[model samples]
Target: MFGFLKRKIKEFITGTKKEIEKETKEEKGPGERAIERAEKEIREKTKKEEKEKVEEKPKEKSEKKEAIEEFEEKGKKEKLEEKEEKEAEEKRDGLFTRFKKIFVSKKLGEDDFNNFFDKLELILIENNVALEAIDALRENLRKELVGKEIKRKELEKEIENALKNAISSLLIDSFDLIEKIKTELKEKKPYVIVFFGINGSGKTTTIAKIAYMLKTHNITSVLAAADTFRAASIEQLEKHGKNLGIEVIKQKYGADPAAVAFDAIAHAKAKAIDTVLIDTAGRMHTKTDLLREMEKICRVAKPSLKIFVGEAITGNDAVEQAKAFNETVGIDAIILTKADVDEKGGATISVSHVTKKPILFLGVGQEYGDLKRFNKKEILEKIFD
Candidate 1:
């Protein structure tokens, strides 16, 4: 899952590290050469002074004066040699320290970060991350890395952590669905939930999965076949109901969807059912008529929660659908289907942040038990750990 995006992110980190290292080497090359040249000049100057001192000799001096002068000259030459050796050692140590500093104390300036982020932005876009989510991630990472000092050895880990944090921030905090249902059941006899999405997004299957999950927790629920427009939509719900051994409340095709929702809520109330899962008709988000029908269902059912279901593989399209539904009906949570097969995983990353809603679950597979609750830690770890 998310294999492609994960690989791309890892590659970006490593490639950025290498680029920075290469640039640092190039930037410091000239200064290093200058230091070497200065060292060589000092050594040549010391050798030339020694040669001139040896070549110059006074032949007309007295023996005592010549002897004293010879002793002084020898002492001075010894001292000069010692001083030259110490200076040379100091110069070498200074150069070595500067070289080590390049790797051990490299700081990322603002310009360097901007250059790196340009590549990251393209990677994210190619992976299907929404522009708004990308902008948020960019700002978060910029704050973390720009103008910050980082050791060359620790660069990759630092970048990973920063990216993890930035992505983690994009996901809204999710609540426990089972606990929320149980809590709501304490006061209200039946908890109503309505599912919204476009066609072929696995909406019905996800509803069944949720029902199965609730049933496992000993919470009884009834299925509402409110999707009256689509052909065989009622039969599909009935099939899932049969598989789950849960009763399905439905009317004939072309019946009022809102009326169907109202009937389902009434059935739940009469039966003292713990919850009512209303599956609405899937249509294009751009279709105002369909959106209005969804609103009517919500108005009639007065659902405790409204969920937007989307396909994880659709990426930004799924995000836009969620956003539109949220704008129209105010979705409380989200569920992305086909997550197991989604290699990009951008919808999972962008949906919550874009809609300002929490993702309740992910439809990983076809089984009823394949609905995995969304957890931020697992997501971060999957991409970076």
Candidate 2:
């Protein structure tokens, strides 16, 4: 899964590690070199002063004069040695103090990660990640990677771990559909769940898959074909109902969609159904009239859960659609379709982060059994491996 994105990210990490290692080997840091030069100068000056003192000794003198001169010379030498020792200590302190300043800052320098992150941003854009999501990831990576010195041999592994953690933080939100439905059923005999998405996002198929999944757990559900705007939509849903042996409640095209949903809820209530899965028309989020109509459906149905269906292969478009639907009707969760075909897989990562919603499932293939529950650990492993 996500083979293209995975390969790109891995290659970038490896290439960056090699570049940093090469730079570290070819050139030493300025701070270390400055300290080395200061120590060399101090040693040379000390040796020259000692040699000059030795050459200045007198050959002969009277005993008393020699003794007095010797005492005076001893005092002058002691004072001179003290002054030199203090100056040397100050020079040493000044050199190493400047060196310590280089290592104590809380953020990495531009030289540490600027080039690497610039390339990463470009790669994410090429892979169709949303600009907002890309910015969020960049900020997160900076926080995780900065303030730490790079270790040569361990640099790759450290970067990989940080990236994994950053992605997981954005995508991981725990949700269990079956358990949630079971709990909802306790309060109301028929729990209504409405699904909406843009046209051709595989919304109908996802509804059918959800119905099939419910049946396996011995829970009964009714499908509400409330998508009255599209004539084929109602028929498509009816076909899915027939295949699954579940009842579909629908009305004629051009009829009010909110009425269809109300009727479905009434039927579910009358029949004591365990759940009601309502499929809305695949209208573009940009259409204000259609969006208002969707809002009417939500107001009338008052569903326990509102889910948005999105196509993973659609990339940033999917993220935008999800955001619009969420703003209009307030989606509680998401289900991404065509994940198996999405080599870039940017929508899956971007949508959840942008919407602050959990992804409940992934549509991997055509069969009903192809729906897979979203797992953050498995996803990170696939991307980083």
Candidate 3:
């Protein structure tokens, strides 16, 4: 579904990995080289000492002169040995200090990621990823990749692994809507779900798809045509109900939406319906009166779940819309429509992460069966494969 975004992300990761490998290969860390230099100096000093001792040897001397000269030479040699040992100790201390600095500097240095993250941020913005989401990812990548002393040979693989982990963290969260509904049906009788979204976001169609899905599982549900403001919204719900052979509880146009939802819930309770899916009017997030109406519906219906429907192809707009709805009515989850046609499916990541909610399903196509349960593993694999 996210073909364009996937390609861009993969390219960014590959490019970043190559840059890290190149940098690591070209410049050796100071700590390793410092240790090597210290060892070489020690070896050279030892060789020079041995050569000096051999050159100082003399022959044909009296016992007294030989003994005196031997004693003097022994003292000088001992003094020289002490001086060399002191120098060696200082050198070892310096080497250790350098090593300590390297260890402490293990976190990702600013120089290492500045250029790389700049390019990545641009790529994400171009793909319509929300600025907040991009920032979150950047911070996470820094946490995963920074300051770690990865070997030059392992740089690429290490970077790739970190990127994978960061992406998964951003995408994965526990959400099982079907299971939740099944459990709720036992205690709640008819689990009510209110769907909200802006106009042209495919909210009505998504409602139908969910109803059809539930029917397949032998879960009975009633449709609430609570979208009284929209001209054809009620007719739309009735049409879906007729096709699915499910009951539709609707009021006339210009009716109070909250009353329609209340009636729907009451009907579901009396009929022992498994669920009551309430479809609300498509309203702009900026419209205060419309948002108030939504609040009234929430208060009156007391829905078990509030779902926000959005168009994945709308990109950042969808994210903003979802946020606005959540702020006003507090959504429990999300459903993204038109995923099959959305090349840059940044809205999916943006909405879920920004709102701290799970995406229940993806509308991949126009057919009722095109609804796909949101799977974090499958989505990540598709993007990174």
Local accuracy of candidate 1 as per-residue lDDT tens digits, 1-385? 8899999999999998898778767766777687667767766776676556544543333344667787886677678767867776677678666756664546788888888889999989888999999999989999999878887778889999999999999999899999999998899879999999988899999999999999999999999999998899899999999999999999999899999999999999998999999998887745688678988998899999999999999999999999989988899999999999999989999999899999989899999999999999998887876
TM-score for predicted model 3 compared with the true structure: 0.78
Clashing pairs in 2: none
Q: In candidate 2, what are the lDDT values of residues 1-385, reduced to their tens digit?
A: 7999999999999998887767764455674577678767876776677656644643333243668778897677678877876786787678666655553332346657677789988888888888888888888888888777766656789889888887887895859999999987888778889998988898889999999999999999999998888759999999999999999998899889899999999999999999999988887745687678898998999999999999999999999989988888889999999999999979988899999999999999998888999999888888987
Total clashes for model 1:
0
Which lDDT tens digits does candidate 3 get at residues 268-324? 889889999999888774668767999999999888899999999999999998898
Which TM-score value belongs to model 2? 0.80
Clashes per candidate, residues 3 or more apart or on different chains: 0, 0, 5
Q: Worst lDDT window (10 residues) for model 1?
A: 55-64
Model 1 misses residue 237 by how many Å? 1.0
| Model 2 Cα RMSD, 1 decimal | 8.7
lDDT against true structure, model 1: 0.88
Q: For every model shown, what is its TM-score relative to the native structure?
A: 0.84, 0.80, 0.78
Alpha carbon deviation, residue 261, candidate 2 (Å)? 0.8
